[model samples]
Target chain A: MTPLLDIAELAKRFEVGNKRLLYAVDEVTFAIGRGETVGLVGESGCGKSTLVRLINRLLDPTSGSIRLAGTELADMRARAFAGNANRARIQMVFQDAGDSLNPRYTAADAIADPIRRLKKMSGASLKSRVEALADMTGLPRELLSRFPHQLSGGQKARVGIARAIAVEPELLILDEPTAALDVSVQVVILKLLQQLKRELGMSYLFVSHDLNVVRLLCDRVLVMYLGKIVESGPAAELFADPRHPYTRALISAIPQADPDKRVGRLRLSGEPRSPIDPDPTVCRFYGRCPRGEPRCSAEMPVLRTVASARQAACHFA
Target chain B: MTAVPALAVEDLSVEFRTRSGTVKVLDHVGFSVDKGETVALVGESGSGKSVTAFAVMGILDPAGRVTSGRALFGGADLLALSEHDLAEQRGRELSMIFQNPRTALNPIRKVGQQIADVLVRHGGATRPDAPRAAVEMLKRVRIPDPERRVEAYPFELSGGMCQRIMIAIALACRPALLIADEPTTGLDVTTQAVIMDLIGELAHESGMATIFITHDLALAAEYCDRIVVMHAGHIVEAAPARELFAHPRHPYSAKLLAATPGETVSLAELASIPGGLPDLRRPDLPACRYSDRCERRLDDCARPLPHRVIGERHTVSCWNPL
Candidate 1:
């Protein structure tokens, strides 16, 4: 069966000073099945956010294709895609709800903006739809008239989610939706997203650096570093036993809630190599990988099937 | 545990005078830290976690006033000291690591010079020796190529590196007390782990009493020896980390633990707290700040809350605890 969203060999590059090119996203390939949640986990500057932006058409890809339901979206430019017919098919809930929301707009108006732009609906119908969306997201309908400043963090997050789902999109891209919230509020938002995905039957692309949250929310997880997908596998299985060395290190870095289960962490000492004009032949995790071998630097490790339903970009794995 | 706690605070109340009325920011907030002990003050945004740190550090804003309280540091009272006396102790005897290093640091100055300023200002280092000492401090924080990175400005470094510099400056004087307010809030998990490791290491070497302020209970449970849970400017519970998580006494503490995104439970099973914190400015504020939203709240909760000692180190301020 065709995937809900399929991206192959997608790349986005930026030219830095001195004519050096920075590969923000390079040769990335992934697919999200209908009603599936795919997690993108990476360290800072690992190109996870760039991949999501490219999918959302917030950034245009320099190469490769993005197909939604087998429909080509890469040809459409970022600005042009806004008015394109597929605009409502893909929506993004930004990371910081407080800052992403317009302070001047009320909660009702914030949700209504997407519907207005995509559906071009106004008047009593629009108002009722906004209230309905709020209700679906477990937001108090009475607070819809209040501005963003008046809402609590969880309420603001609900407003953000309500806005993204206003158009009833098939694919939802959440960029660390609960990163700004407290633990008490984060679980609520996470639970709400899970329920929404089940009820709406929409595929989800969750971009976050938090492995624990991804473990709870995602069906499959992808680990990226320096513009490449290093590992991909079933969420629980992958975390239980990571194939790639980078994935192992990333997983070990998560502080376990249980003190007795203290992990003998796989510490990666040096910072990741510069992405600017990176050597195409060298593995991205070579310098930092504890089990680094000469073969890692001589040739890039491509993603190869490793287990029953998993892949890792490591020659040794 | 010792002759005296590294720092002891008692009946610390704070208020901010606003245009409309005086807002009570803290209501008799109190906690203690032992020398070489790490205690985390965990709470939501308006829980006054940072305010407690600011009050103890004597750095409250002009609009804010310490209505009542006593903060005993070593032998001296931190609240009784004048501004000038407090300044002497800030960088030397006690220091703080702010939330965002990018904003907390001086953007214009080179990262090395910033560290040198702290060392020379209050530490025993002389003006000429401060720069070299600063480089050594950077190396201690495990920043690679200290010599080259020393001259790099704050803007030239990444968020994690800037945070390392912040840690370096805070630990420069080998302070007796360290206050880290959300030190790893915006950082990546790996970087957060590294930064936390560095803080733990430095605190041990210097025997500094650390008050880690964060909203992340998982992190607090992992790193801190003791946990102090706050709500609406009041400390709801305080206990050893393992004891608190294993069996939370206060209703709010239990709710907070349930709300944490641990993999042990399904997403739907995880629950959120029922309601928001009570308005501090309300004329009829309840004595128990968490009573308004607590499921275990009883009529007795409306009366003045009393501290109930459950265990050796565990205490809860509630009429009906879990």
Candidate 2:
């Protein structure tokens, strides 16, 4: 069976001053299987947001193909793609629920706007559909008349989820949906996402900096650094024994809640190299890598099979 | 254990006179940090962790007043100090690292000048020599090429770099106590680990008492010597870091631990705490604020809460503990 989304050699570049091009996403290739949850983990400036925008058709990619269910989405201009039929097939739940929501729009109006625009429902049907969505997302119906300011953080998050799923998309892109919420509320929101996926039969591309949450929810995980994917594998195996040095450092940096489980961290030294006009021949993890070698600067390592279904972009892996 | 604590806050109660009503932000809240010890105040938003720190730092908004409290530090009652006296003691004996470094930092000034300004005012540095001291401070925080980066503005630096500058400014005078309120909230995990390690190392070397306020239970467990769990306006539990995680007596602490996602826990196994924080402005707030949401509440919980000494250093305020 064909995957829900297949991205091949997708790249986006912005021209900084002095004609220097900042390669935001560099030759990234990945796929999301049907009903699969794929997590994208990376530090800031690692191009995760750019990749999300490219796939969601908010930003046009400079190169490569984004095929959704065998339909090419990269060819259409982002402005024209708004009116395309595939727009409804892919939806995104933004990071901050409160900031993403317009304060003037009530929860009901926020949910109904998407449905009325995409599904083209009217008056009574729109109200009922909004009510059904509120019910589905476990948002209180009575609170739908209230504005974003009147709602709690969790309630705002529920409305955000409700709005994203109003048109019944096939693939949901959640960009740090729980980052702004409390831990208790985050658990509920995550579980709701899981249940909604199971019921709706949709694929999820979970983007977050929280590795623990990513490991809990994702089947496969991608670790990106400095505009390139350094590793990709099953979440459990990758986290347990990460192949890439960058991945290992990232996994070790997470502060475990259990004091007994605290281990000496693998610290990354120095800042990330400049993204503007980066050396195409050298590996991205060269200078800060704990096990840096001369060969790392001499050549770049492409993703290759390290295990049965695991891939790592390292010469030593 | 009999030695005077670096900072001791006793019976701290604060209220904010807002347009709606007077909101009790902190009710008889008290905690202390020993010399060279790191104590974390952990809680969700509106849990009064930051407010407690602000009360101790004398940085609360004008409308917010401390009704009753005695913050004893360095043979002085900080709460009763005059404004001029408190200002003198602020950066020299007490320092704070605010949550957002980007906003806390002066956008128009060079990062080096900001650090220099703190040193000149609090560290007794001369105006001419302050820049050199500022560069040394930057190097101490492990910022690469401090000489060149000193002239860069906050906007020119990344989030992690800006945080390092904030740390440099906070520790310039080597204050006796440091109140870091969610210092790593917006930073990446790797950056957070680095920043935390830096703070821990510096505190250990200088024997500076630290009150680290954060909502991340795991981070508190990893870095702090003791953990104080707060809910609404009260400190529900206080214990050694490892002891609290292993044997949490308070229902709120247990629920918060169970709610946090960990390496081994699955999504289905995670428990979400029911109900939100109670309205602080309510006139008839219960003596035990968590009793309404707690599953182990008893008739005794309606009365004044008891701070019980359950173990060596563990204190819980619940009437009925797990």
Candidate 3:
């Protein structure tokens, strides 16, 4: 079966001064199966956001193909993509629900805006649909009339999720949806997302820095570093036995709630190498890798299959 | 255990006046940090974690006023101290690392100069020799190529780098007590580990008392020796880190732990604590702030909460506990 979303050789570059090129998203490739929740994990400046923007068509990619359900989307200009019929098929729930929502817009209005724009429904139908969406997302009906500021963090998050799914998008892109919320609220939101995916049969591209959350929610995981995907595999297998050094560092860095579970951590020493005009021949994790050797700096390792349904970009995996 | 604590806060009550009304931010809060010990003030936002830290630092907003309490540090009352005395003790004997390092740092000043300013002001270093000491501090924080990076501005560095610079400034004077408020909230997990390791090592070496305020219980469990769980301006539970995780006596603490994602728990098993924090400004608030959302609440919850001693070092303020 064809995947819900297939991305190949996706790259986005920014032109810094002095004829320098910042490779924000460099030759990334991944796919999401229908109803599958794929997690994208990486640190800051790892091009995770840039890759999300490219797939969402909010920003034009420098090169590569983004095929949604076998339909080419990269060829369409980002500006024109807004009016395209496929616009409603892909939706994004932003990181900060409070900031993403318009302050003046009431919760009801926020959820209705997307449905009205995309579905072209109005009057009683739109009102009932908004109410239904609220009910589906477990948002209290009375709170729908309240503005963003009047609602709590978890309420605002519910509104954001309701708005994104109002159009019944085939794929939902969640960019750190629970980063700003408390753990108690985060669990509710994560459960809601999972339920929504099951009910609607929608695919999810869950991008988050919280490895614990990713491990719980994602079916497959992609570990990106400095714009390149260093590892990709089944979530359980990858986290249990990460092949790439970067993935290993990220997993071990997660602070375990159980103090007894604490072990000696694998610390990444130096900062990430400069992204601007980086040498293509050198590995991105070379300087910071705990197991770095001369072979790592001399040759860039291409991501290759190492085990059953596991891939790692390293000289020795 | 008998030695005078590095910092002892007794019944610290703070109130903030807002357009709505007077908000009781901290209600008779009390905790103690021993010398060379780390205690985490763990809670969700608006749980008075930062407010407690701000009150101790004497940097509470002008609108906020300390209604009652005594913060004893080295046999001196920090609350009763004058502004001048507080200022003198702030950078010299007490220091804080703010949440956002980019804003905490001087934007226009070079990173090295900022570190130097702290050293010269509190470390008694001459202006001419302060720069050299600042570079050494940067190197100690593990900033590679400290000589070149010292001249760089805050904006020129990454979030982690700026945070290291902030740590350098905070530890330059080797203050007896340090308050780090969500120092690694926005940082990556890898950077968070490194930064936390750096702070832990430095504090261990200096025998400094650390008050770490963060909402992440997991992080608190990993780094802190004790965990103080706060809710609606009240400390519901305080216990040793392992004991708190292994057996949370308070309902709120148990709920919080259940909510936190872990290696073994699946998404379906994670139980979110229902309801939001009660409004602090309400005049008819319940004696137990968590009673409204608590499943084990009883009629007795309407009365004053009792501080139940479970273990030698564990305490819970609750009418009905787990």
Highest-scoring model, DockQ: 3
lDDT, candidate 3, B182-205, per-residue tens: 999999999999999899999999
lDDT of 1 by residue, A170-241 (tens): 999999999898887788888889889989999999999788889999999999999999999999999888
Point out where model 2 deviates above 4 Å: B1-3
Q: Interface RMSD computed for candidate 3 is what?
A: 1.0
Cα displacement (angstroms), candidate 1, residue A183, comes to: 1.8
By TM-score, the better pick of 2 and 3 is 2
Which is the leading candidate under TM-score? 2
Better of 1 and 2 by DockQ: 2
Single out the weakest 10-residue window by summed lDDT for candidate 2 chain B. Answer: B1-10
* Model 1 regions lying over 4 Å from their true place: B1-3
Runs in model 3 with CA error above 4 Å?
B1-3
Q: Clashing pairs in model 2?
A: none
lDDT (Cα, tens digit) per residue for candidate 3, span A34-64: 9999999999999999999999999999999
TM-score, candidate number 3: 0.98
